[model samples]
Structure formats: C-alpha cells, structure tokens
Target: MKWLNKNRVLKVIFFALVVKPLVFIILGLNVRGKNNLPTKGPAIIAANHNSHLDTLVLMSLYPLSLLYKIRPVAAADYFLSNKYRAWFALNIIGIIPIERQRRVRKTELFSGCHTALDNDEILIIFPEGSRGQPEQISRIKKGLYHIVHDRKKTAIIPVLMHGLGKALPKGEALLVPFNCDVVIAPEMAEFQTADDFVKQLESCYQELKTYCITTTEQHN
Candidate 1:
C-alpha cells in the first residue's frame, strides 16, 4: 500500500502490533545493557547477524516513538530481489539497502545510510556483513568502517545477540521459538584508524561473548 510508505503512523502501528508481539511474546528475548541503547538518533547499532529475526529483535528494543527513526542496513540483492519483497523491506521495514555484488561509488553505496545519519536516525547494522552460522559470531566487516570513518561524532554501540540462529537460521523460513540473549554494550571508543577501529569492534564482540559465559557460570 502506498499509504504504508506515505504514512509513518502506519509503519509505527505495524511494528507495535506485529513485530513487538512476535519478537517479545512468541520468540521471547532476554536483553541486558538496555540502558545502553540509544534513546535518540545519529547512532549506529553494530551487531552480529544470524537469523532474519535479528533485525526485528533489535528494532523492537527501541520505543515506539522511535520506530520510524530506526532503519536497518540490509543487503539490496537479498531484500530487494522482487517487487513484493522490495515493497515490504523498503516500505514497511524501512531498510537502507546496500549493493553487495555490483560495483557502485562509495557515495552511492552508503547514500541512504549517510542521509539517515544526517537526519539523526538510528541505524541497525550487522558488522558481520551477512548471516553466519547459528550462535556463532563472524568477523566484523569493513562496511561499517566506511560508514563511520569520518563521522566520529556519531556513537557506535556494539550489541551481542545469541540464539536467533537456532530459532531461524539462514535458508529457513519456519521459526522455532527460542529464548534469545541480547547484550548491548556502551558506545565504543572513537576510531583512530580503520584497522584499529575494526579490531576494537571485534574485541568488543569477544568481551561480550565472554560476558555471556561469565554470567552463565555464576548462575551454575
């Protein structure tokens, strides 16, 4: 529906009615460091990618007031394969699609993301690039590096998510209900060099993983 695209209210209603319930009620989520989640925009949410549910889970963490402001950075090839999928992703989910296979200018590639940042919109980015194995964190990609290279003012918050892969891994459509773990880290340090910043992100991921282990060990 064109109305879906024209009206932000409808988009907010969809997430409030559908995404929230499906993520919080059907799947169930255990989130820590929620206090670290950004209340406003111009922030980058860097997280590991697993199931498609990862986007929904992350978006649901934000308040309904910020629903329209939250845009997930997704792959153009996968999400925009056809008209129906394109409409849903672009109109409903409000994703900033990046061309993965085709060669495009740096400015053209990250144009949507840049605009989002300029508008103080929160961006949900999976630093791993694409979905990896269920419950396994992949190496942080350089794409995120390019987006934030010059904009040191914007906060980059590292997030560690668990169990979504098992619930709905890559190539599977049916969702198996699972209790998910989400740890939202504090804003990462400002970048010095590309290598240093990426390494810091990877290190942050490891620390969060270790935090999960330490917390589980304490309960045992």
Candidate 2:
C-alpha cells in the first residue's frame, strides 16, 4: 500500500497548480451548500458518475488540509489495467481500486472502505457504478449502502454535479472548457433501509438539478 500512502508533495503540486486553477478558475466552478460539509470527520461522499472529471471537481471543493485525507474509489479493471495506469491511479491520484468485473469477496470490498473510514478519511464513491449520460443519474448500487450500513458513524454526503460530462464526456480525451455546478447537500441519516437510502439519494440529485436550472434561468 505504499502507493496509497498520503504524499503531501504530490497532492500539493497537483491540486494547487493544476486542479484548482483548471476547475475553479478556468472552467468556472459554481458550488452550492458547501457549508453542509463537516469540517472534520469520516464521510462517504456519494455522487453520480459521468466524466472522469467528476472526481477531480468534487475533490477541488475540499480544503487543502483535508485533501490528503480524501480517497476516490475507482474501478479496478479500468484504473489498474496497465502498469502506467496503475501507477497513476494509485500513486498520483491515491484511488482505492475495487474489482468490478471478477467475483470479489464481500470481505475484500468492505475492507478497503472500512480502512479508509477507520483512518478518519473521506471516501468518494459513485453509487451509479459507472458513468452514464451527462446529468442523468443512474440506479444506485448496493456497495455504498453496504459501506454506510457497516460504518454507521461515517456521515453520508450527497453531491450533485452538472456539466462535467460535457466538459470531458465519456470516450473523449480532450477536456472542453465548460461551466460546472456542484451542490453539496446536508449529511443524510435516518434511512430505515438501503432501498430507502437510495430513494433519498436520488431525490438529492433531482433537487440539485432543479436548482441549477433555476439559477441558469435567472442568470439569463
């Protein structure tokens, strides 16, 4: 897990010079309800997946101090396919890869996530499983629900991002400059079941979409 170790130098160089200016300055990121995030605690950030930029955009919103504690859960088959890709994913990005295709033991999947939370780190998970059409949220997966179920102390933060798919859509290498909005809702709790939690998660996405549309209309 040497690659997974928090490298302050790498994180500083990447986010300060690259991600921050690219996302917040050049691309023009609009964030709403950011105050809802706890200043410090173990959290599970559940958001819709669209573009590869989705993870970067989400992480950029966090304070620099907390950046080192953030870990994005990625697909093992895609991110760890080759040596170069694996190096970049584990070393540079500090992602926790999970086997999505082959049969993975439940213990294996939960172990990685549990360790992160146990260390008081933030875990970014896309419950949709994979990227879908831009701005279209897909069905929630059971992985997130299971993690939350086990780690009851960890807070669940529902996030909604718009325009990222268009900026760097699926299958496209180049990133087109586009304005994006990210809405961070209050931490959710009190769900009786995982299915109930999924419903609430979907609702958070829809509410954020509506807010984005309204804000856009007002600006126009």
Candidate 3:
C-alpha cells in the first residue's frame, strides 16, 4: 500500500494522458461552476454516486497541480477484491479504500479520513454509499455525517453529476460516448444537524439537475 502512494508520477501521467482526454475530449464533458471549488483543500466533495465515470469526471474538475491531493473514497470490497483492481484503485486512481461491510472498525474508518484531512488533502466521498439510477440521488448515508461531525472545520462542496449512468451503467463493461455535466454549488460551512445537512445536500443535487436540464433545453 505504501508503494501505491509513492506512485504519484504514474497517477499524474495516467490522468493527464488518459483520463482527462478521454473524459473531456472523447466523452464531451460539460462542467459548470468549477470555480466554486476552493483554491485550497482539507475540504470534502460530497457527490451522488451513479457510475464509475463519476469519480473521473469529478477529479477532472480540479487542476493538475491539485490532482495528486485528491483522494476518492472507494468501496474496499469491490476495489480491493483482487490484486489487479487493488493496484488500479490505489496506484492509478489513488483511492482510499473503506470497508463497506460492518466488519470494518469505526475507529479505523475515522482514522483514515482524519489522516487525509489532516494532510490538507481533498476527500471525494459519495454519500449515497453505493451507485443508484442515473440522475436519481439517493438518501445519503451516515458516514458523511460522522465525518463532518468529527471534522467540523472541513468545507463541504456539493456536486451533482448527470449522464454518467447512461454512459456506463452498473454491470456494464463498455462505455458509451455521452455528454456529462457536473454542477458544483457554493461551499457550506455550517449545519445544525446531520439529518438537516443530508437533506440540504440532496436538495442541492436536485437543484443542479434541474439547472442542467434547463440549460441543455435552452441550447437545443
């Protein structure tokens, strides 16, 4: 696992040469409010999960200088199931694996997240806990709530992604060329309760989705 973190050069090369071009040029990604992302980090990017493309699309919004600092939280059961996938997730994509099952200790989970934020890195967490239908945002799980509760100072950036599920839906191997849009909202720093925060986050996703649809129709 240590070697994986040391392979920063490989990660940059892969994202710059492969992921960026494939997502931006080949797939035709349309991103709005990218400047909403903070110049510095130690922040959390909470987004709705749909497809594998969501991670790549979100990471593309950041500049290369901050690329290495971006650490996505991925399901350990899936990404670390085998050596090949583990290497790809850890080294290539630079993901921080979290055990989705109940077997993982709570202390360990919080520790990993704390370490990342303490390092002033960006953490991309999908609060849905798993993938859902395209454009359909699910109820956020408690993991994000706990993270925020523990790390009070971290800024939360709400992001909504559209068209990723159609491009590469669940259980599909091949990716269809499609236009994907990512809408980033302004940062929220205060929350009264976990439930309230989650509710507001879901609302943000829906609002962004509507904005995407209206913008698309107007252009057409």
The total of clashing pairs for model 3 equals 0
Misplaced by over 4 Å in model 1 are 1-6, 213-220
The backbone clash count of each candidate, in order, is: 0, 0, 0
C-alpha lDDT of residue 19 in model 1: 89
lDDT of 3 by residue, 66-89 (tens): 788898999889999999999999
Candidate 2's C-alpha runs over 4 A off are: 1-6, 213-220
**For model 2, which pairs clash?**
none
- The residue-by-residue lDDT of candidate 1 on 63-138, one tens digit each, is 8777888999999999999999998899888999999899988878999999999999999999898897667777
Q: Quote each prediction's TM-score.
A: 0.91, 0.90, 0.90
Candidate 2: tens digits of C-alpha lDDT, residues 84-144: 9898888767898898887868777678878888889888999999998665777888888
lDDT of 2: 0.82
lDDT values for all models: 0.86, 0.82, 0.81
TM-score of 1: 0.91
